[model samples]
Target: MVFRRKRKYREKIIKRSIWQQLPEESQNFFIETANILRFAGQFFVELVTPPYEHKEMIRQTYEIGYRTLALVSITGFILGLVLTLQSRPIMIAFGAESMLPSMVSISVIREVGPVITALICAGKIGSSIGAELGSMRVTEQIDAMDVSGTRPINYVVATRVIATTLMVPILVFYADALALLGSYVALNLNSEMTISLFLNKVLGSLGFMDVIPATIKTVFFGFAIGLIGTYKGYYSGRGTQGVGKAANTAVVTSSLIIFIIDLLAVQVSNLLMY
Candidate 1:
């Protein structure tokens, strides 16, 4: 009996040791990701069959889209300017300075503009949604809404999700435009080129294939960011501290999803382009 008890104790120690070796944070992340997928499905369901919140959605769209314009514009302009300036040395080295406009346009349209714009949105909007919802959840405001016959999920989550879905593309377009303008400015700083000449090269290089694929992927980026934010916020725990955690987690997770989606999109686009 004594030997058996010692064996059992050793087994228990082995089990505890093994469990400790496992990555708890990774396990929790998988669980959270699964929960977000479920929450995303629920959001779609609520969106399609709704006591539609038109007023709230419009409000959210304005908040997400209009309020974001200045920031997006500035970022895009700087991005284009910097990209142009950076690429200049390389192009000059290659004796391909003439290709600058097309090259910059292609890079901005196909990758940089959409990705950067989406990332910015994720950082700003994702954190806000998470903190707002997390606060409501922790303070029992969500509970109050439920008690009062208001579907908080539909009213809050759905509207924001839809707003994000619609707004991100617009932001991307604005970013692309501003980035191109910046590129043009950068080019003209070193050389005298007509606006018409620069635009012709830019317009010539961009095809349906590049523009369409880039735009399509941003929609997924927006959805992922919105869904993760809502999921983190709606289900946040640990009270006030959880709100901060949710915000931080929302930004991190949403950014990760954006990169993953962008990778898949690039693969798809390559296959289609080829």
Candidate 2:
């Protein structure tokens, strides 16, 4: 059959390491990039316009922020405890046990707190929004909303985005506090570090420069996660399979974007620090 022949020919060309398909892939990437850019532009435009979804946004904030506190707290504590415990041997070898508090505090505030919080949010929240919206699209619920004169973008996308933007920074604050508590707990194991001394050292080591830049970057991270989740879910392919794909791809892609944003944020922070 002609179909079999065409398939065979295509495989033959590919096995020959032909450059014929490279342009197609490049073109597809550009096309996808353009579409995403347009989607983001629409999002911003709708974000500023009137008829805000205040109630929905608030509800989402509670769901996204309050409901996830336990997971974030536990993860943060373990992270801090492990980080301190792992770094302990190095500090002890160098006879820098007294400096452990300051070092751990700086590392948490300047980097670990925001990064870990964002990664967790990306996995928990990003896939959630993506699957929710993807299911709506698959079941034609979004279309029904359109017919009812409801602003799906405003009601769904905007609320989720704004909620994420607000909640992630708050989560980071919790993570930082819990991480410090964990650090204290870890310090007490096989050592006699006092709570007062730990607090004093941590406080002394921190400043506006550490907190402010880290907080600002977290806002951007939250925005990226929400945007990708919303975008992937809103424009997902056809059927329940598409819903699964959307959620899967959203988490993976958003996590990658988080790292990308974090790298850029660190570079910018460094440039500004000098």
For model 1, the stretches where C-alpha displacement exceeds 4 angstroms are 1-22
Q: Write the per-residue lDDT of candidate 1 for residues 15-76, one digit (tens) a residue.
A: 98976777999767667778877888889888887699999999998998876788899999
Q: How accurate is candidate 2 locally (lDDT)?
A: 0.90
- Using TM-score as the measure, the top candidate is 1
Q: Give the count of colliding residue pairs in each prediction.
A: 0, 0
| Clash pairs for candidate 2 | none
- Superposed model 2: Cα runs more than 4 Å off: 1-22
- Please state every model's RMSD to the true fold in angstroms: 5.0, 7.1
The C-alpha lDDT values of all candidates are 0.92, 0.90
User: How close is every model to the real structure, measured as TM-score?
Assistant: 0.90, 0.90
Could you tell me the TM-score of candidate 1? 0.90
Per-residue alpha-carbon lDDT of model 2 for 73-122, expressed as tens digits?
Answer: 99999988988999999999999988888899899988898899898999
